[model samples]
Target: MAFFQLWNSDHGHVLEACKDSLKKLQLDYLDLYLVHFPVATKHTGVGTTSSAVDDEGVLEIDTTISLEATWHDMEDLVSKGLARSIGISNYDIFLTRDCLAYSKIKPAVNQIETHPYFQRESLVKFCKKHGVSVTAHTPLGGSAANTEWFGSVSCLDDDVLKGLAAKYKKTPAQIALRWGIQRDTVVIPKSSKVERLKENFEVSDFELTKEDMELIKGMDRKYRTNQPANFWGVDLYA
Candidate 1:
């Protein structure tokens, strides 16, 4: 998979950025390509993410290039065979609905921050209803790294997941992943260690009961673990 970042959201830079990604990845085609965020930022250059910021350090959003226009270019990628599938990321339900309305090729997926603490059930249900798959990016509540970056505690530490883990003889992370999978959402948990990678992959063996799924569902505090406002100086989600 590859992502179209803020700097490459412009109509002219989109194709070049994708080609550049293919060259760097040494691949003939990408299985999936996604717009990293809903909003566009100043075009720094192809293969560059150094989007310009205002004096107050807010990301200089490019209002001239709308997401509808960007989606048209993304659709072109599918037609050109550069990508087998193209999607969006970090989009709320309203933006997602807009994309569905105006898109020639419907978005295949919406990658978003979701976990026990931030289940986002409505968004998940809506996307699935529209034939758009949901990919959970921070499936394990972002772990310790998210705690530092977003100041939100990891959902792995929650009593619900830990209790369920003990019952199933699995790690809290595995329980969380199972919950996401049970909900029909694809999970991408970040891990660097070999043991952790193995642990994360070992979730398919167990399935959460209907009641247990409800327990985790009730654990939702509606808290988002990945907040760009810390660096972007704008609350896009707000």
Candidate 2:
């Protein structure tokens, strides 16, 4: 399935941006289209992700357009057959609840940063309870690249995960992915290497035990790996 995310700067041009993406992909419709973030930023241009920043280098958030209005345009995408499914990303429970209340088409998915280290139990429960599927974006806690790019530690390095890996004869990454799958959240772990891709896919061969799942549950440090604050100059999570 072809999935694409509309950048925050493209909120105002949702229609145009989606059309641009479809055109670039040469597809009549997208399988899934997501609002990259709940917040809106100054419109740079269609198909552009560069955000407008203020004098202090903070992102220039566009407060003029409400998320409700943006979501309305998103709903229009479905009506026009531009996208088959619509969803949100990086949204917390409060924003998601608000969206569910106001949205004509309930969001099919809420993609969030979730892993053993940052198990957002309440948010996951809320979305699933309301019939919206949760997609774990950083399902394996962003792996080592997170540490290199965001200076955040990977959950794969945790001793618990490592120990579990030894017991399951799986890699630490696979153990983490298994934990996410058992939670009923769709896990999308990223890796470019062919071996790593194969390793990531091998999780389906083994099932994490109930006790093992509980052990991983206890690994939650409430730590979010992907921190955009260093670059955005603002903490959206805060």
Q: Name the candidate that leads on TM-score.
A: 2
Pairs that collide in candidate 1 are none
Model 2: how far is 130 from its true place, Å? 0.4
How does candidate 1 fare on TM-score?
0.95
Candidate 2 TM-score over all chains jointly: 0.98
What is the TM-score of each predicted model, taking all chains together? 0.95, 0.98
lDDT of 1 by residue, 1-54 (tens): 554432433545678888888888888778888888888888777787665788
What range of 10 consecutive residues in model 2 has the weakest lDDT sum? 44-53
Least accurate stretch of 10 residues (summed lDDT) in model 1? 3-12
lDDT of 2 by residue, 1-238 (tens): 9999999998888999999999999999999999999889998889887878899989999989999999999999999999999999999999999999999999999999999999999999999999999999999888788898899988888899999999999899999888888899999989899999988888888899899999999999999889988888999889
* Top-lDDT candidate index: 2
**What RMSD does each model have against the real structure?**
1.6, 0.7
